[model samples]
Target: MRQPENLIEINYAANQSSVDVDELGMRDMQRRVFAEKDAQYLLVKAPPASGKSRALMFVALDKLFHQGINKIIIAVPERSIGASFASTALVQHGFFADWEIEDRNNLCTPGGDSGKVDAFLRFLEGDDTVLVCTHATLRFAMAKLPASAFDDTLVAIDEFHHVSADKDSSRLGQVVHEIMSGSSAHVVAMTGSYFRGDSVPVLMPEDEEKFTPVTFNYYDQLNGYKHLKSLGIGHHFYQGRYTDAIHEVFDPDLKTLIHIPSVNSSESTKDKIEEVNRILDLIGTFEGKDESGIMRLRTPDGRVLRVADLVDDSDLMARSNLLGYLGQVAAKDKDAVDVIIALGMAKEGFDWPFAEHALTVGHRSSLTEVIQIIGRVTRDAQGKPRAQFTNLIAEPAADADEVTTAVNTMLKAITASLLMEQVLAPNFNFKPKEPGEAPEPGTLAVKGLKAPPTDRVRQIIETDLNDLKATILQDPGFRRAAAGQLDAEVANKVLIPKILRERYPDLNSAEAESLRQHVVVDSVVKAGEVKEVGDKKFVMLAKKYVDLDKLDINLIDKVNPFQRAFEVLSKSVDPKTLRVVMDAIAETRIEVTAEEAVLMYPKLREFQRMEGRVPSIRSKDPHEKRLAEILLFLRRAKASQAKVNA
Candidate 1:
């Protein structure tokens, strides 16, 4: 049995600063958001288990009492997440008031849609200050109630990525647009996964610009932890059914959450309940369910493992029983459960602090879902020194027609891991180096790094760097470049700017270039290894060591941001499988567009002038090889055009 490969292993500082509460019962992340309470349109992007719910309470309470907001309408993606906003006694923890929602006002409980919507309307009109409901309920309620009904209310949407800018497809997003456009309601959007997995913009550029972003990055949340010291992210590929290969990566000793593939996915066996039972049998002999409905499995050894089967939701009673038990699990009793097998229920907004390992058994299509699943195990808890996320993917068969799809899925998984690497590492403050300027501590200066030319660019660099990189890593062009099919410079100078302009259409050429430089610089630096030799530190960029303090933007741009992912892929998978992956990529990789050819033509000429010869396709240099490919592409285009004319 092959063990899981560790692609990204990041250790935190364990400073305990993030978990520490301030005078107002707010954790470090909460306090950061609370300070921006005055902004009517605020977006708080924080990692899970970072007290985003409590942070909303702090801000909502302030808005209700001080900001003249008449009511607080809190909407979550699902009903279970409403519990995060359940009435809390904040005054006991040194706050001005408590966050109390009357039972009737808490519209997230089990009930009919019409009844919940009626209750929602009653609460909005009545004297109640806070109401909790799911996004579906809110969307339904908004249909019945005019946008004016939301006037003077503070609407807070949790897991905000669910609301897309595409109003036609996203009803919740349409409701939000209506409220913002037709009424004067204050809005606060919060999300653990800032970027959506579907690649849709959560908000239109104009609407997003209205919100003042308060970003509490994963690095700050994890690095300031009290107990969790490190996080490892990796993927394992199995030739056949994943159930048979479970033992390869499954560790019974760790408190784990196993997310089985959805029945609809190709990787699934199509029988979720049977899959769960198969996993149970593999683990040990099934003793039976205990009184609380949690399955009791006797391992090969004497130890009995408590498994929660969320996949078998046909038995509502048993599912409810397990949910109740999981709800009571906390830091005090970290070992209340052993493993959880679920198809889809326990990803976002599901809190389990004791979860040390999240073993996901398929390629998660959404980066957002991956982030949330990882969040389940990242909570700070006593005795839980480390957290892990493992992706179990199906290896592509060279003979299969779906091999292309399989290869794409494999690359997507790799990209997700790479993005997490960027997210989990410590945040770096990068600046343009100035002549004779004194070196600053904790700040990285790169020669020729473009400084932000506008406030909009500055805001993007400050809050949206990871999100930008997320989009870039997922781009087909960047992935091909990372696989060594194209030049790193083409990806850095051409493909990256294209994404930036499309995402932020308002950006001029200069602004887009500035943002592009920052994205490339940040990614390349974070992807590189930092080494300290004696008193001096050096960073390995493009496989060459460069003085960390004297780095250059040009040097960083020459590096493939996903180079580490490629290296990991080469090491983790067998060469045959790797060949399959490469072949699939080459077969489907986007040909160089005429626009991209136009962009590279000048650079190709410059290369020819500098080297005193046209670049060779067989050149060891990626940049030269890319130019050679582009030259060939253009010549083929010219010959095809001439033939058409004749």
Candidate 2:
């Protein structure tokens, strides 16, 4: 479920955890992450359950116990995630000392507070080696205390996504910057997710370079799993809100965690009581509160199902009973938690090992939210082999005649946009060039670099590739190659390798050649580059497809996940047909004054007759749409001018 759209079987040595040196020894990435201990600042871009908390422990311990660091402050977004830094078994694993987080200093638990603002100053004045505090508390304390007060400490921030360059997050960001500038405070920023939906830089370019980055790709983590096998991400479209179609995706047999839509979500009616009642009814007969004030419910088929309501009801007893169950790691009774209805809880650090499926009912626009929900079910439990994430989105129900225009263009677009991000990481198809030759169109071949490449430049081409996505199917040369119009010998053995090297300059001649063949095989298998082979069933990559049962993992690792989907999408719709749609939506350019637009009203009427609807000023609409806008604008301006004259 990690960037479900862009899962590759690529492995990194850092992903392999080192042996348990003591008891709970460091993971391979953890071992490698610690090797950068000498760095003044570090950014560990690891995946969920990649033992980031433990890694931070080893580094913080080194800075405190070994290095001459004065103090260590750990900040997390939520109190629950603070438990990640709780006392560890590291001493048993041969570390110099175990991490002992005092309950009093653990602001997450009940303790003295002028808020944590006052406690933070007290802790800094004392000799506490490590203090775990939430970002809000730290932000508040930093306001009260001088930046120098936090100097000489290693300040580690978890769920680092919330710390960004935006003004909303600037409070904590400025505080961290101030503390670092005032004194020599080192920072270890950690986040499981890469990008925030709003597209703000987490750290400024120059500020970011100060930290050494250690990345553990999702493919590496899930691939290295001992018990968990494959992770599946799917989208199920239903009529109206998911409330209208819960039965389609929900399975009582699956240990599911359903993320009900927020009030703002299109699927949400925003009626919490109605939402709860509807869900309870779907599962079973809601027989009111049991002896313990918990809701007792039975399914339509006579099967007993225990449901825990995470939403607070107006009734104090019902709300209090649910609050009592808020932070429990797991339900005490085995049969008690068949389904836990939650909002704003049970996510990001709450562990539920029994979860087999993570289901959400909404259009979760944020990629960070999507990844976090997936993490809910990915935790490996004994005997549990696979996990799934299903997004139940509202599909518009319009009659066939209105499918293209009225049914729900916006709805489908939103759904496709969400799925596209999961299916494909924004891609840039880069190809390397020969000496003294030009780079491939829409690709920047890194060549003649006096110094090594930066992650930024490389990432720009990779993540922001959509703008420059190549028109492969439309290219004459590629089309000829696909249609067998070109000579096979020259096309396959020579031209393809040249293009691959041009696109991937990092790949040497041999590597490029290998990739070229793989790309060609991929192109042909997709039924785009090669035709006349009826019913293409096999796909050959780095190696030839050998048998039905086995696949070469190494070659499979390099296969692009987007190509299969791309081929189906591309082949289904004719390019010429798409052009017609574009023409239908295109707006004709015009130069007209307010008076002139009035004169063109009859011309606008022609469009209304032709299209069978009055065109409006739409950025996405055709030339006729612009005409309507122009006429309307002119009429308004003319009216204003007439008023002035009078």
- What is candidate 2's TM-score against the reference? 0.66
What TM-score would each prediction reach against the true structure?
Answer: 0.95, 0.66
> Where is model 2 more than 4 Å wrong at Cα?
1-24, 111-113, 287-296, 313-336, 397-646
lDDT of 2 by residue, 546-607 (tens): 32122232333334322333232233334543333233223222234444354456667787
lDDT of 1: 0.86
Q: lDDT score of model 2?
A: 0.58
Which model scores highest in lDDT? 1
Candidate 1 per-residue lDDT, tens place, 590-610, comes to 777787798789988998899
Off by over 4 Å in 1: 329-332, 598-629, 640-646
